[model samples]
Target: MRARPGALQVGSFRGVPIRVHVSLLVALPLLALSFGGALQQAAETADVPPGALSGHPWAWGLAVAVGLFLSVLLHEMAHTLYALRHGGEVHGITLMIVGGVSELAEVPKRPRDEAVMALVGPLTSLGLAAFLGALTWLVHGLGMFQVQFALFTLAMLNAVLGGFNLLPAFPMDGGRIVRAALTPRLGLLRATRVAAGLGRMFAVLFGVWGLVTLNPFTLVVAFFVLMGAEGESRQVRMKALLERVNVEALMTPRMVGVDLDLSMQDAHWALRHEHVSMLPVTSAGRPVGRVTWAAAQAVPEAQRGGYVVRDAMEDGVVADLREDGWAALRRMAEARVPMAAVVDEEGLLAGTLDWNDIQRGMARAEEAERQRSGPGWPRERTA
Candidate 1:
């Protein structure tokens, strides 16, 4: 639910990267086993020979798993493309078995826009269901019922996907719609709490149901839902506090700067000496660009002297001291910059806001909030 680490990029969609976590591979065996059984039933109905699937279940199972993940990808892209059309910036999409999440740069401030974006994924799933249903009918009509197993399974799954995602759980499209719908009446924080609360309630039911039926998959989904619900609520509360804070307060008091004419070795020394991932490039006491660890390391040691700081630096976001802390953080994340040059009223560099600064500032704020409110993790309530 929160941004996952090291999600491998599979490909790109409309210029947005589509990625999958290594954990997503966990579902393959489960779905393959499940699909293999479904394929057996379909084989019986179609009067197909047992030898068709008996030869290699591995091939069949993996094929279905990949197919299902593709469906999930398209479902998420529906959300991403819709958001883009309505002025949202898409970072990428990541597919985990729980579902696919589109990493969008902006969270829409409007309830109607949120609802529209939230509902689009399910709508897209439903569309896929209908299209697949028609295709299945045609295939079956053509007496290719054996071939319809994967198609039929996908159709059923998409139908279920559309229905399941509409359950109104936090971080899920349905829960977002609930929060958006209730924001005007109950207010943002209260609405998120209510939606997330409902999600926890659903999670409990799912967990109980899983135990009763001895279903591990249901329990896994419930675990993610519960974790995601709490995470969403916590993030919303943090952002609310972040809006009141200034970028200046969350920045390093002193940061190293590299001269534009400095060689790659000089830039590397500045980064190492300051214990920073990046160094601000300065020319005539004015900021030019920034050289990050990744860029510096890319320069061959043999030719290090030939490359100047300017050669390795890239343009980066500059944070205004007076800007909201979270807004600046968001800008930095969107740009994928390792650091931000925090500037004062006169646009002179005052300090630097890097990953470490953001982490420390947020941790301190959360600590203060916990001490003031009496530390307690939100517990799921029994309905």
Candidate 2:
């Protein structure tokens, strides 16, 4: 699946970009409201003097919200730093409504390393919680009731974050830990299936509980957990299927092209005759961009004859034929393009690769593996 252009890049941590999604922005106010209300009630229960706060809960709530965001960032940073120290590359950290995600370039090869990497994030949060708890005690001794309460709230929140992440659910820190533990005995793919199955079960339970309790937040979390588990399973499967494959082996070998100077009407006709949705637009028989049937049809039927294929075509991802198949697929996914224009060493148009080509390649790989290993190979099982 291609990446969408929604995340806003705030800055870089070391060399990795830090991004915030618009969903986080929407979540902030809600978080503030919830935190603020809780603080008011806690303040009352503690029998604190009215002058201690002397104001509405919004201020403290907003402060806590901001603090929570920072705490989540720190949690993700711990994961990123550990991954980096272990010779893994991080793409970036993205803060979303659910939490922060440290995008590792690839999973660690060693199970022990992966387990430790997963363990670090929750440990960091728990450590922060403990540290804040001590700081809150010191502030309380200093007679700063408001500051102490905020610190105490943050301490509790960090503690909750740590504990919640430790639950065994796929794509979560805990899920990764479980997968790592099972990897040696079950193999990576099989372990992931086991972990992912557990995650799905957890998701369904969460969803049922949310429905009974009438909690929208729990429902949202359940939905994400389910989706994340399925996504992770598919990714690991794709990786295993594409192992030892190159773009040359997976990509379509036939070079389908539409001349850059060809009219959109002609391009449409070519698309119809070739029975292909997309065709690379070539200038001097070299791919410049790609035109799709949809792009051609976007132009009015009468006006299409006046516009050239170059005018209708959009710049697309260009994959090197010699690169790894998975690498090329990643490039296409990042670009969010339907198909990629493949090129040779001399920059000559080679062929194309789309979802169909990748699916075909994976199917072939699966069949070959089945033939070698006999029926019921790579069965889903636990350690």
Candidate 3:
């Protein structure tokens, strides 16, 4: 399944693409309710009468919600900015019901860099809380009733948010710091396993607590944390497994091709007569584009005689075998492109590689390892 609420590029900062998922729109109102409720409770506790607040209930709710989201945005931006300073690419920052997430294109290559990036977000939140707390204290000393109460509540909420994020759980800023600390000694995979395991444990605790207490918020948070940890772990494992692997190792070098000048009728005949599902549209031994069965099907029978292969073929990114295959694969996967053109050392079209080919190669590799181990090796069941 795709990530909920399709992603949209909002903007960029320092070359880092900022994206937000559509589901974030749903989260905003919930965040407003949560923060507004908290602020309302705090105001009551502080002996501030409800009517003294400047805005109506809905306006107050919206204000608190905006403040909370602003805090979250700052926290996530800290992570993104820190990563950029370290020469790592930040894909985007996403806000969800649980909290915010800053996606880094790759993990920090150095332990120090990782630690800095992980620590920056929480530190930023803490700094904001402190600043707000000072402002609240100053306003209280100056006998400003409404402003002091509002600032105090906002500061307290930020402190709580920062404290919660610093919990030693996977998918949290603190957990990332833990991973960074353990990376040198345990290696990245083992470090990730530890962090993810702890994260899952915390998620289970949240879930069980929610069930016992009948708190829907806790249950939702548990699910979010669980899924986030699992996803991160799976991504790390895939990247580790695919390291140094090239497209040439798995591509079908015997890819069939049709002349670009050929009519759709000719392409359709080839499709019917040949077993291949797609053909590389080439001209004079140079690669151009792809003509698939689906493309041919779209052409009317009568028009097929006049439609050239170029009219039906779609353009795609082509890569040489010597390039970083894992990077290329990651790009293809992210773009949702189904296939990649694999080229030889001389940059000539050598073959085509699809997602199936990659999976098949991985399967064969796993099977070969199993056979070499004489069936005594522990085999983990996979989904």
Candidate 4:
């Protein structure tokens, strides 16, 4: 599980790196304060002796906040461990302000396998709640009121976490479960559409409820769910469209290349005159990297004459001419680049591909699909 940009790597477990998102910094203290105040009130109601707990209520609240996140980590770990056991690869787990995400490198192809994988996370959380609840009984017997109270609070929170995750929300385990359940009857694409639609419906309901209750966290969660559902739906549709397409079919052939030693001023002129947004930078007649028009504009006018294409070029994705479009798109996504350089068998540049190519390909594919397939298939979104 690899963390995305803007997250801090805190530690690793069983070979999986754990990352904390920046938003957690803002959310943690607020959670601590809320939990602390609740704990104080509960303690007073229970008539616990003053000597029973020694620290400030906020200190204990902070401990509960940490414990809650740890439970979330365990919940994600359950998913990772199960996936690894069943021959699936996990990128890593990321802990964000809302909850945790277990990034599986590739989703399991089998519906049964996926359903079980999705079910295990919430099951693990519920199990944690049960174990903690039992531990609280032991603490109460030993007359450790503080320990008992903390354990009880954590148990209730774990129960809530487990229950909340069981709701059908796309890209969440519950939504995955729903998709898996429908895949046998509807096929993967249709099952994904149905599941994602249900998730969006749930998101709408949550958003309305949040507005009615004036809960900002609920509103944020609703927005997250809505975006996740829409994103998954688009990804599945794109994967279907590009699965059989190849790089050669979509790439711009006979594209021009710029020399690495070309002055930035000249490169900028070529970019404008050639009507291209980016150019492949070549070294010794071989594609090395790429420079964008934006990169050219970053250099000051006075320095453009002194700087070379090599000075502004960044790493470019290279794709094989025969590579399937889906795989090439995955590479581009991972590289965080909008375009890729395509090479033939002899390792010579054949062409270049960018978002324009993808958009055109998608349009053609959708047209072809409409002619051959039945109605109700998801339509491609405009680029």
Candidate 5:
């Protein structure tokens, strides 16, 4: 059977579309409110005549909020462009409450490439700020008072956004710069450890100050930074350990199988008695589809005995054991496939390999390798 298309698609400008996390959707209104409040305060402080720009303060504030978000989009786009230029593919750009992220298919392999990719986003923001500042100054010289004021506000906002993003925290541009610099010399793991450690330190300090000052937003940001850094570090370690491993080593050779002609009763008994949730549907010794206990349960008891396994089974894509484990995993994740049938040289079902099994096997292999190289083990003689 043909493999299913992965969830991620090459979108406009070769970017992928990433569904914004539900949490981000929940936070959008709050972010808009904060930006609007900032604009309202700025306008009030400037003694701008009420109803001059918009009849209501909220209207003007919302405009500023929208403009700020546009600036953020530009910042994320800059990162995505640089990544693509350097042979990396971007999944998508997501604008979260904290800021935005340009999700890449893989991190840059070289430290120099990493540094360039990390630095581009902030630099783009800074350049925008500088250009707007220059335009504001020119407008002031030309005696365009209203234009000057609007440009000035935009310039200042962009500067603040750039500065905030550069605050040396993990998952931030500044933190990425630190990691990039250290990667070549200290290695990715050590570099991540150092960068993440610094990030946690900042997170703790921010968290404490937020609590003492009773600022819930600050607390939220601190917690977000802390968790992001921890998760990033763990993911890096996991990828490093599993690199270059293949699917064959991790799959189960003896998968539960059912003939297409078998009645739903046989499938149900196999599911319940054998404790196997999934069964490969076969006909003439070849896999045709897959049946799960959940599918079996969906049928009414009265009709269950009359149904054939083929009638209830769902056709699924299978993976070759010789394929790269990491690539297979990525495909599975993108396709939203729970499990893949592992096939051997002749395209016959060799076994089944799921995501959990691959992770567990890699962990065990790494552990074994570590023990073998530990003290008291004789090193193999080299020519």
Candidate 6:
């Protein structure tokens, strides 16, 4: 999970870290309102004393909200455990209002692997539903109607959650299963297109249904579904381009370090000629800062010829020699830096991994993928 500023790290489960997303704060109260209403209605139906609803309906609402998300956490864990066993690395899991997400470094390598991982989440939900159903039954027989009502509500919620997630939409388990089954025959991009297309269709249908029924919850879910499916398609395409690449292959070994005496005009020429936005500034082979276009332009144009690159540069771009290129892209994208100073184990400047480098690598990989394919089929990773 990508931890934003102020995000709380709860703990780790079997080395898979879990964190609470900020949105969970908003989701909790909303869930409390919805579930609280249901609980109050159940009390009225069961003819429980008015005190149950009147005394502490908020408490009941809070319990349902917390309990509901606990089940969602388990659903994500099932995916985390299964993914780790299948040549994938678990970055972490995150709990949010909509549900949980299992952050994996890579997609599964095989169709069977994808199918298994996708199927496990829904199966976990169904299993929980069955257990809770049994508990609800036992409590009912013991004349603990209040406990039974709570248990029954949870059981039904799980059943609904499991069923709802089974909708064949991209970014959902059933959609993944559909893509997995299709990947063997159709190429990956084609299969992905089919799945994503179906997902968008369903999203529209779900949105329309939500509107017709005046259910804002369903409409919100449909919006996420649509965005999720669209986002996953882009993710797959980017992964395809990045999968075969290593950072070392893309890094420029010649570090163009501009000294403190190198004029801003000289540095500007270097930046333009090299097609790079930033260059490492060094003094006597020791690092000082980085000369960025923004930084260089900040210097008065009239005095640019006199001002040195060091006068305008700033620091903080760094990457390791053997880091995965995709990982590097993510780090760079997050930092919003155009280039990184590639460093060796001893912390010496080794090379530079720049945005231009990534684009070139992506272009080469995409070209190679195209060249290796025949006329009818899309380019694919060879089996």
- The residue-by-residue lDDT of candidate 5 on 216-289, one tens digit each, is 77898898889878977876766666655778887778544788999998899888986878877777656777
Clashing pairs in model 3, backbone N/Cα/C closer than 3 A: none
On lDDT, the candidate that comes out on top is 2
As a whole number from 0 to 100, the lDDT of residue 33 in candidate 6 is 80
lDDT at 175, model 6: 87
Residue pairs in clash, model 5: none
- Please, what is the TM-score per model? 0.82, 0.81, 0.85, 0.85, 0.79, 0.73
Tell me how far the alpha carbon of residue 192 in candidate 2 is from the true structure, in angstroms, after superposition.
0.7
The residue ranges of model 1 lying beyond 4 angstroms of the native Cα positions read 1-4, 42-55, 134-142, 211-214, 263-277, 292-308, 311-315, 363-383
**TM-score of model number 3:** 0.85
Location of the lowest summed lDDT over 10 successive residues in candidate 5: 1-10
* Candidate that beats the other on TM-score, 1 or 5, i.e. the better one: 1
Measured on C-alpha atoms, candidate 6 has an lDDT of: 0.77
Tell me the lDDT of model 1 at 47.
50
Candidate number with the higher TM-score (2 or 5): 2
State in Å the error of residue 160, model 1: 1.0
Q: lDDT per prediction?
A: 0.80, 0.83, 0.75, 0.83, 0.73, 0.77
The CA lDDT at 15 in model 5 is 41
Ranking by lDDT: 2, 4, 1, 6, 3, 5
* Tens digit of per-residue lDDT, candidate 1, span 296-348: 88988788788988877899778888898889878877777768887777666
Cα displacement (Å) at residue 191, model 4: 0.9
lDDT (Cα, 0-100) at 119 in candidate 4: 92
Residue 178 alpha-carbon offset, candidate 6, angstroms:
1.1
lDDT of predicted model 4: 0.83
User: RMSD (Cα, Å) of candidate 3?
Assistant: 4.2
Writing each residue's lDDT as its tens digit, candidate 3 over 1-383 gives 12234777777667666666666677667666765666667677655666566666555676776677678888999998877776776666776677788877678788778888888888888888999988876776465667877787678768877887887778888788888888888777777788899899999999999999998788988998899789878777666556646677767784446788999999998878866677677776566877888999999899999899988898765767766556767666555567777767765678877777878866666566568767543233321
For candidate 4, the 10 contiguous residues with the lowest summed lDDT are: 374-383
